[model samples]
Target: MIRIAISAALLASAAPVLAETHSIEPGDGAQERLQEALILAEPGDEIVLAAGRYHITDGLSLDVDGVTVRGAGMDGTVLDFTGQQGAGEGLLVTSDNVTLRDFAVENPKGDGIKSKGADNIVYHRIRVTWTRGPHEENGAYAIYPVESTGVLVDGVKVTGASDAGIYVGQSSKITVRNSIAEANVAGIEIENSRDALVEHNIATRNTGGILIFDLPNLPVMGGGNVIVRNNLVVANDTPNFAPPGNIVAGVRRGTGIMVMANDNVLVEGNLLSGNPTAPIMVIAYVQPYDDERYNPLPREVVVGENTIEDGGYDPQLDGADMLKAAFGGELPPIMWDGLGSLYVSGDTPGWTLGLTEQGKGLGDAQPAPLAAPAPAADFDETGIGAPAELDERLG
Candidate 1:
């Protein structure tokens, strides 16, 4: 009897442990069913959505660690939150080791999908968008991951955000690749974040193509070690329609890429074209904020081997009038605001802007000192930074 019991136990241990799968079909009360599944889900559970549209009124949240929520495909499975009332986001994830894939979320009131304070989260083949065109009332961000570590956003498409399309803020070890962002205020913004790689993405017709920014009064202050390579940023001449109080509202239109107040950033091997403003701009975080903890300088920035074409045709001479005046309204491929005190080459105390090799059709690099101090009125009226508020809300 003991030998038989031992053999049975060994067999049981050798069998694979199967995770529970909760499948939700498209029908009335589907959102409730999804919420119930999430409430009852334990670790290693999988929630699968059917290949149809689910009209969700309230936002859905998943807090179970090591759980996966997937759909049939990005095109087949749709979560439409057009009339959402209860939640500020379509889906909120606050669990570790979570994977969300193969789904489309649309038209949330605040943000499309947000993951907060989670580690090892993966969003793959997911689409978040507004069916309507770009408007200020659209959600602030699509596919936003904040204060999270080991996050990967791959093969995603985002559009019609009032702020950024794919925004990764205050996070570490992040990667956003093979993504498409368009018709947003700023596409693919990495703010107050570190150790990120953004590559193989296409950003077009946005206010600004890609922005690496570090704002003040955030828990995560300085951002560094970011690489943006092999991306196509073109024709980002959409007018800035962000709400008046937001910081991105100050972003000039027709800008291809803007790097503000970050360190150790590299922009290389990208194809940029047809931006009316400058193709690449490097400037300090000159906003008037009283945060002593914030480092406002951008250091160790390398702009290497990027193909630029037909830029500086009609520049948006909004904030930096000095740049427009100095370049005679025809800006160069790369424009740097000489704000750094560190010496780069032979007694020239300017920002460490490096251009190793230039591509064809790019104008000369124009690194000039700021003509005057930034005006205090240029700061956004919203006193508290949005990212800090978002962090508090996520917490």
Candidate 2:
């Protein structure tokens, strides 16, 4: 019996493994080969692309859960979709526990890399770009993950997106760190997402550096508990070329960081400079809409311990005309729209906006004019207001 047990243990130890690896090289019919590999892939499989340019006309989709798609390196492996015939995104991921890393995706007709309804998804050391610079025809988002949970985007670089270079929308527990975004409408945007942490990022030469917005009419609403910290948000004066009807189209050029209609957001420990518009803007979503389901006011926002320099001059008049008229053509480092109703205690409830006094060019929020102009009847025509009123007291 002891001899039989020893032999059985040895046989089990020698059993073959189930993990498989597939590699695709650059050549004719590369897309077909990749598609075949994806179709054949199972859970716990790895697919690798060789270090060369794979010119693909159709978008790629991976629906296998727990699969890893890897490339030689972000600089060496390129997926060029300039001649894409697909009408949608470059890469679509719908599987849970998937990992995509170490590759570059360029010039897709739509979004660069998008993951929908995926959980525990990670995108690391990846680069996505539009080579033609910012244009309305460029893709909407570079790295977009919507309706995802436990999403992580780390050490990635994105550029030249018409809407947002790195956008995480309708997601939860997202972490975006050690990334760079440039020359996009809204460089890095967290829209309608909750429990997001955006840190250690450099956002420059975009229309708006980092945006936290909660707009009406989406799968998710009322984003909260976001933290934007330890980031360098600078310059960001690129012209806004987003196609009309997109929420980011309203982003003012030269703005560094904007928090609009979100709740419980913390902006801290960031270096903001060279943004001609307001370096930090906290505004309510005053768009006229009949949907009472959407909360248009930001609540319990705290802006603390940030370094501000050389901002709030030469505003983007197209979006900041009201700010120009109100502040004599010069904005402040920290601006808040005082547009909510006063509580019975003579102070706004959770609607109070807080900013620390440790930064330069920080100004107290001025009271809104009594009988201020009502927002445009069209929801899209309403502009985000300039500084109105803030407490300047940090809690």
Candidate 3:
């Protein structure tokens, strides 16, 4: 028999390829058995999403590259896209070392777990929610990663995202840690990313709390070697329900930790409280672009050492009560707009807007108070975050 059929084809090519799980369960067809186990997963498969509530009507995709779509614990595996009749994202990963753990995803009409160009991705403890909280047709982003490199968003817990409840665009080696962005408009956004690492994290009632934008014509413009440390930006006074020509509807409600137009950015040890529009904001990307390789300013920015409280009293600017009686009863937790290159180390108490140009707005005001100066050395923490083997897949 030809030597027993060549030893059964060399014992089936020397057997050693076991790597499957695929336990998907949850009533009825379960969206065709969870999109047929993410299209018959291969490369080290593991699509176990079994623990109830999966009424997803439409969106669900995965290109499969080292798959691992686990579940059964981001509040017990819910995935109920409130009868989604289409797609945009309710789970759309384009493959490459994927690992979206402990799922939840509710009401995902448009973005609630999107991972494009997904590379070394690892969004652990995922829980994108839009339980009708902050609406504008809620669902802009709830853990939406884009154009990846090696991103790791840990312990996720987004809520009501009208635009940004943990959104990382463009992307490079990124790492948005711990995580818990609430009432979103922009609660944790790092647009046009680069070597990023917004640490710890706990942005509250979001309108804008932790945003490091570098805009100008997209396909990824020069963002920065970013690193916003130890966060807990509080009381982000939500109200920017974004949905009108959205760009976070010009986030303002109670902005906190916003650094527009990046470069070697680094804001440190945070814990700002009751952020009433300015619990640390450095600007200059005042929009008016054509992207000649854009450079809207914010260079070498650094505002270290923080633990501020009762920020900017209640000033949603445009001369709010004469700047809160000229910074006596409020307004002062660092708010600069004087076009970039900022650095205010300790004794932090600021104010600026002395804009000279760049899409001039605030009525071209000259607010003044933030006398910056401090960090001159030791700021460069090379190659920022997200690439320590993506934290061993959040084991």
Number of the predicted model whose lDDT against the real structure is largest: 3
In model 1, the runs with Cα more than 4 Å from the true position are: 1-17, 318-329, 341-395
What is the C-alpha local distance difference test score of each model?
0.78, 0.78, 0.87
Stretches of candidate 2 off by over 4 Å are 1-17, 318-329, 340-395
Candidate 1's displacement at residue 81, Å, is 0.5
- Candidate 2 similarity to native, TM-score: 0.81
- Alpha-carbon TM-score of each model against the true structure: 0.82, 0.81, 0.40
State in Å the error of residue 79, model 2: 0.4
Error of model 3, residue 354, in angstroms: 22
Candidate 2 structure quality by residue, lDDT tens digits, 135-183: 8999999999999877888888999999999999998888888899999
Pairs that collide, model 2: none
| lDDT per residue (tens digit) for residues 113-151 in model 1 | 999998878888899989897999999999999998777
lDDT of 1 at 44: 76
